[model samples]
Target: MDSLTQTIYECLFGAEYYEVNPASDDNTKAADVLRALFSANEGGEHLKKSVHDIVGERGWTENLAKAILGGIENALKQGAQMGKTMADASEKAIAEAVGFARDHPYFCALIAVGVLAILMPWVLEALGFAELGPVEGSFAAWWQSTYRGYVTKDSLFAFFQRLGMVWH
Candidate 1:
């Protein structure tokens, strides 16, 4: 293995180099090793340390070292900016949703009721208020038998009746 490839391998893996003939040129081999390290989900700090160690040992020209370091810094800055942008967007969306909910209380209440209606069966089952047994027959028969008691008219009427009492 070439000196550059050997140095990179040692810095990144903390071991001696093993020759793998994937690339003909030294630069390609080095690039391939770096790419593999990244693809393996190696942490950024480890990669940065390896690169710094490699640069120091290789005795490259000052300009080349500056260029490489500048590129890494730029990439880090862009990543931070992208993360900030996403966080700001999420905050804005949440604020808008809260504003809409506050402005349209009745509409929000209706939507909540609709969502609760859809999720009530699973909610009840999770809370041990409803128990579902293994399927025994056709889909229609199972659905009917499973939900009939939980979703009957008396239960819904009682729920709304209680809700009305709470309002009064």
Candidate 2:
């Protein structure tokens, strides 16, 4: 009976099912309350199995079943709304990440280049380089040791200036 109540609650509220007030030991009243909750939205088929399990003891009529079905429809609508809200939040987060990356092309390229450099040692070792600790050390020691020296305003601008000169 307790299990039946829990199933009914979960079917109605989804995530917040456990947070709501549920009926205690009274199977009859629990069935009635669940019926009313379902009646608002057409939830009959959603909880049919749980209701069927207790029908004999709870004495559910056809009218009660119809009302429960109605409640299920309402619950479905609420679930859809929750899903939309989560989707909106995810879209906003992705948009912000894209905007930040767009505004910092040099930083983005540096991150990509750093990742590639870090992977190059493993790649080189796979291709039969025996003593390439210098390459590994270069990447590992970059940010922690001399990142500020290499990425200073004048230094970075100078590097870009050299690149422009080469390309031009």
Candidate 3:
């Protein structure tokens, strides 16, 4: 029953499932309270104050408590289901994306080029390649300027022309 209570504590408060960190006062108190209420071995009366404090609180009705427990149980189940669904879909989507990229090299290349056109400036500045000024324009205008500026440069004109051939 302590295990069940600990699971409930974790599900409700995002506490660590097993190890109750002694370093954290809140974790210790939470662990103690759970043990006080639910431990079959040596608890409850051991912290007589805690049990009294809980029972003394208003609206400690059995029906309300049961309802709250049901809600928590439902939420944990729904969260698990959502996580599993996302995991399954993401695996399939990534596999399909990899296959598509392999089959359509040119299309993938274009996407890469377009992404680089938009992101290169930020990446360059972040990596200390260039000291870029703050950009002030609509994102579309910024992307167009960045793309045209880089492609038209003497350093990369030949590379841009090769990419243009793929576009043509």
lDDT of 2 by residue, 1-168 (tens): 378757665565343424433443333344455543334333446445555555557575654454344444445556533334334554587799899899999888766644643555343333222242223344333432456545454554333333323331
Whole-model lDDT, model 2: 0.47
Model 1: ten consecutive residues of lowest lDDT: 126-135
Model 3: residue 42 alpha-carbon error in angstroms? 40
For candidate 1, what's the RMSD?
A: 18.0
Off by over 4 Å in 1: 1-82, 121-168
**What local distance difference test score does each model get?**
0.45, 0.47, 0.46
Model 3 C-alpha lDDT per residue in residues 38-117, reported as the tens digit of each score: 33233335456664564455524543354334433444455533333334554587799899999999778767755764
lDDT at 71, model 1 = 33
The candidate with the higher lDDT, 1 or 2, is: 2
TM-score on alpha carbons, each prediction: 0.25, 0.27, 0.25
RMSD of candidate 2 to the true fold? 16.9
Better of 2 and 3 by TM-score: 2
Give candidate 3 regions above 4 Å deviation.
Answer: 1-82, 121-168
